[model samples]
Target: MKKLVLTGAAGRLGSYLREPLSQMCDRLVSTDWTEDIGKLYPSETYVKADLGDLEAMEAVLDGADMVVHFGAIGDEAAWDKILHSNIIGAYNVWEAAARKGLRRVVYASSIHAVGMYPKTQRIDTEVPHRPDTYYGLAKCFAEDLGSLYWDKKGIESVHLRILSAAQVNNPRALGSWLSYDDLIHLVQQAITTPITGFCVIYGVSNNDRVTVDNHKAAFLGYRPKDNAEQCAEEVLAAADPADPHDPGQMCQGGPFASVEIGFSGTASMNIVQDKKEI
Candidate 1:
């Protein structure tokens, strides 16, 4: 690829993606609301922009091969906050990418888009969305937006319903964790696949205890090498036994499913706040 664009370049996941993406493409334009993302990688340039801003997005997207859109409020937040950053921001990215004639958009959608589904059911990519929070709802909106664009504008997209892409710190993570290496591999698959009209792939690993099924998306060739199974014994030992009656523990969304809508789930979530700047 000649040029690639990445939103949320300052985020934890983006921190890991910067170098690899730069290596794959001739030029990588990394953008975020921040003034800087610390240091730049080879073939990577920084641009300050917001996903909610159409003009800025258009300018950054010009001449790009594909866009890795991870720029959003990563956690559950107020309705207005989710609206501006998640909902509107997603639209701007798609609109800008389509206008620029980009081949595809690899979106950072969350598993929360199907969080309300029970983990016991073992759902696949074809299942209808059942968002558990405003944040999850935004993912659904973006995925639908990607589909609409593909159907109407002939623009293609790949929605990665990421389960967990951070350190495996809790019991729930054993089934949902996605290693950084696996994430980079997933993006590469999304961008290099010969033809993907509009696809949805779960961003997860080969964990032995997984609840979400990825059999339908196997064609993307995202064979994850890393697995959360290694940490299962340790994590499960320290974690409290899951209550079947508890909606949060029983559902695919975990804590997000039990929390009230428009409320913060970060405090309850066992997420690693990786602060190191790339």
Candidate 2:
């Protein structure tokens, strides 16, 4: 590819992606609201821009072949904050991609989009959106926005409804863990696939207790290598008895399902700040 744009360049997942994406394109343009993202790859350049600014998004996406959108608050937040950063930010990215003639958008969606579903039900990409929080609602909006753009503007998109792309320290993570290696593989497939008009796939690993099915997305060739079972013994050994009545324990969204609309879900998840420093 000639040029590829990556939003949320300062984020944890985005940090891991910068080097790899730089290798895939002749020029990798990374953008974030931060002033700088430290050292860049040989083919990478940093663009300090906010996702809420349509003009900035347009300037950042100009001439890019595709975009890997990961910008936004990754946790449940107040409605106003979610509105500006996640909802409006998404519009700017998609609108800019269409106006710039980008080929596709590999969006970083979330499991919260269907967070209300019971963990017992093995859901798929086609399930209706049942957002658990304002953050999840934003994801639902972006997924629909992507669909609308494909139907109306011929812009292609692949929404990866990511589960838990973090360390597996809890029982719920055993079924939702998506290792960083698998994340890169999924993004690569979403970007290189030949004829994906608008697709949705779970960003999860090949865990023994995996909850979501990805058979419909087999064409994308996303064969996840890592599994959370390796940590099952330790996690289960220290696991607390799950209350069947708690939505956090019974629903696919875990803590997000139980958190208040404006509360932070990641705060209770004990997520490590393991950003890949380049």
Instruction: Give the CA lDDT, 0 to 100, for residue 19 in model 1.
Output: 89
Cα lDDT tens digits, model 1, 1-278, are 89999999899999988888898899999999999888798789999998889999999999998999999999899999999999999999999998999999999999999999999999999999999999999999999999999999988899999998889999888899999889999999998898888999999988989898888888899999998989978988898877999988889998899998988876788578784465
TM-score of each predicted structure versus truth: 0.98, 0.99
lDDT of 2 by residue, 1-278 (tens): 99999999899999989989999999999999999999999999999998899999999999999999999999999999999999999999999999999989999999999999999999988989999999999999999999999999999999999999998989999999999999999999998899899999999999999999999989898999998999999999998987999999999999999988899998889998899986
Query: Runs in model 2 with CA error above 4 Å?
Result: none
Give the Cα error of residue 12 in candidate 1, in Å.
0.4
C-alpha lDDT (0 to 100) for residue 195 of candidate 1: 89
Highest-scoring model, lDDT: 2
Clashing pairs in 1: none
Give candidate 1's total backbone clashes: 0
lDDT of 1 at 68: 91
How accurate locally is residue 91 in candidate 1, as Cα lDDT from 0 to 100?
97
